[model samples]
Target: MLIEVIIKQYLDEHLDAPSFFDYPDNPPRRFVLIDRTSGGESERLPNSTVALQSYGKSKYEAMVLNDDLKKVMRNMEELNEISKVSLNADYNFTDLERKQQRYQAVFDIYHY
Candidate 1:
């Protein structure tokens, strides 16, 4: 559970923010950990738009040169899917990255 450990570490390190990580884009963003118990539900979290942004020649070229953003986004998506399945709940996910933002990050979560 490296991802869980990493998420816990990140949360422990950054308690000021509502969530652990934020993408550096136009809009301020965070992952909302959904609690699904007693038939109660929480808000859906935003999804990372890094993959969409990485499309096109220039951005693809840049991503090829440095895979940091892509890797981060992939990890985020994996975490989101895992959380969704683990919690057995639906999520309201959205991407916040704009066309102008070359770098992107996705955030999402679910809890049981």
Candidate 2:
């Protein structure tokens, strides 16, 4: 879970919004939720596909938050534990049923 910690800490420091591994009972108007969708090891090194969902008061706000996240995420390789960071995809992942505006950014993170 080093990558998780690295991502969370990095985002927490660099982004304007808060980030969480689990959704909070009382959430902020804008935040980011981090999830490790899939993962595996290669020769003892770890790699994972992480999904970071940004929620905002409006669709435009969500998109802006996601963009800001992307900009910072691309620089995660500078951190110690993370070896590489690659964006897989990012899109509107709004909760239509709940009517919550959200955007999701997926990434392939390789770490030692």
Candidate 3:
């Protein structure tokens, strides 16, 4: 949840953007979803990955938001004493609506 909280906080403070942990019915055209994926643990440390997907009405719009988010997270590899978040992957797709474009930014997070 550290990754989720850190990402949400950053989006809130910097962009004042709408973000969610899971998909919801009729979500805003412009929004973000932070989803936790499979991960592993070594001793007491948890190494996890999360997906940050930015959605918009157009591909360029989504890309713009994702790029801005990436810039903001460039040096945030460290979230706090408990977690470190690093970018993993960047991808793009369309939502079920087809009209909604989405750009995904995945991150790997490690917690002590």
Candidate 4:
């Protein structure tokens, strides 16, 4: 499976909130949006940097969702196609003008 599909499936099964590659037309107060920002292949191994944005009605809720994501994603090594998963960075990425509370977690995933 494609890495994005694999991640979406995993997150959907593990998390309580809805997740999508694009913002839903009628999104819930709490949700996750994922984007595969960059990728490359080296020595026959493919790797990608995926950014997962967790949104919530409040900053604390957003932080909690981000924590939950990291907790679950830590076990991605169990996936057969995935060789390694490392957190690149994470921080509050709230949109002040729009008044959306969100946190972004970036991960580097190496796979077959």
Candidate 5:
């Protein structure tokens, strides 16, 4: 459900945004990728962690998109079903070409 909500929000905000894992012949200059890389469960309760990455041609553009996502996720607790949606510190990454860059922000969703 968290992934669904996130993907929906991104699409609603950015019409031209690329969908998750959508490898095309020629990708856009800017887009997003969301994946649930890891999670934890105990006593039938679960904690889900997702990686949200904003890719861009420039460092500033990457950060700006990443920050926009962070702001929207900051108050996601309002949904009530999720116990909390918190972000860890973010880090930037660059390709081997050093021409493209991305900023990754990880979020932990405690769903009730």
Candidate 6:
């Protein structure tokens, strides 16, 4: 499937609370939020931040807040290293999916 389609589907399945992403008077904006751990022990985590990046026809923007910025940056750096190791890595789609899956699995295990 196309990366955009996968991303849209993943976003639909994940984000609990809605956050808007508007880019300079655009008619439509993407709504997104990170899927993170909830309750008790999870709340004590240092990496409790959501990172959202939106892309329009001509430009892209990123927003990161809370404790998540550090974790997200670290993960991005790790992915960059992984990309360097894997010459054929499709950083855009593949990396996003991988991260999403990783987090989803982590939440699943934590909740279970």
Cα error of candidate 1 at position 97, Å: 16
lDDT of 5 at 7: 44
lDDT of 3 by residue, 35-107 (tens): 8887788777888787888888789889998888777666565446345667899988667665678999888
Error of 5 at 41 (Å): 2.1
lDDT of 4 by residue, 37-72 (tens): 999998989999999999999999999999999998
Writing each residue's lDDT as its tens digit, candidate 1 over 1-112 gives 3344444344434332233233334333322221212223356532211112222124443334224322333344344334432212222223334342132323343432
1-112: candidate 5 lDDT, tens digit per residue: 5654654564455544554644345767877777777888756667788887778778998888788777866766766566778886578865555467888888887766
Ranking by TM-score: 4, 2, 3, 5, 6, 1
Which segments of model 2 are wrong by more than 4 Å?
none
lDDT of 2 at 70: 97
Each model's lDDT? 0.31, 0.93, 0.77, 0.93, 0.70, 0.27
Residue 64, candidate 6: Cα error in Å is: 7.5
Give lDDT tens digits, candidate 2, residues 1-112: 5678889999999999999999889989999999999999988989999999999999999999999999999999998888889999999999886699999999999998
TM-score of 3: 0.79
Q: For residues 1-112, what per-residue lDDT tens digits would candidate 6 score against the true structure?
A: 3222332344444443223433234322323333332323345422222234322222122222212322332333232111111111111221253232111112211111
Ten residues in sequence with the least summed lDDT for candidate 6: 82-91
RMSD of 5: 3.2
lDDT at 105 for candidate 4? Answer: 97
Candidate 2 backbone collisions, by pair: none
Where is model 5 more than 4 Å wrong at Cα? 1-19, 23-25, 97-99
Q: How does model 1 fare in lDDT?
A: 0.31
Candidate that beats the other on lDDT, 2 or 5, i.e. the better one: 2
Task: Give the candidate order by descending lDDT.
Answer: 4, 2, 3, 5, 1, 6
Whole-model alpha-carbon lDDT for candidate 5: 0.70
Compute the lDDT for candidate 3. 0.77
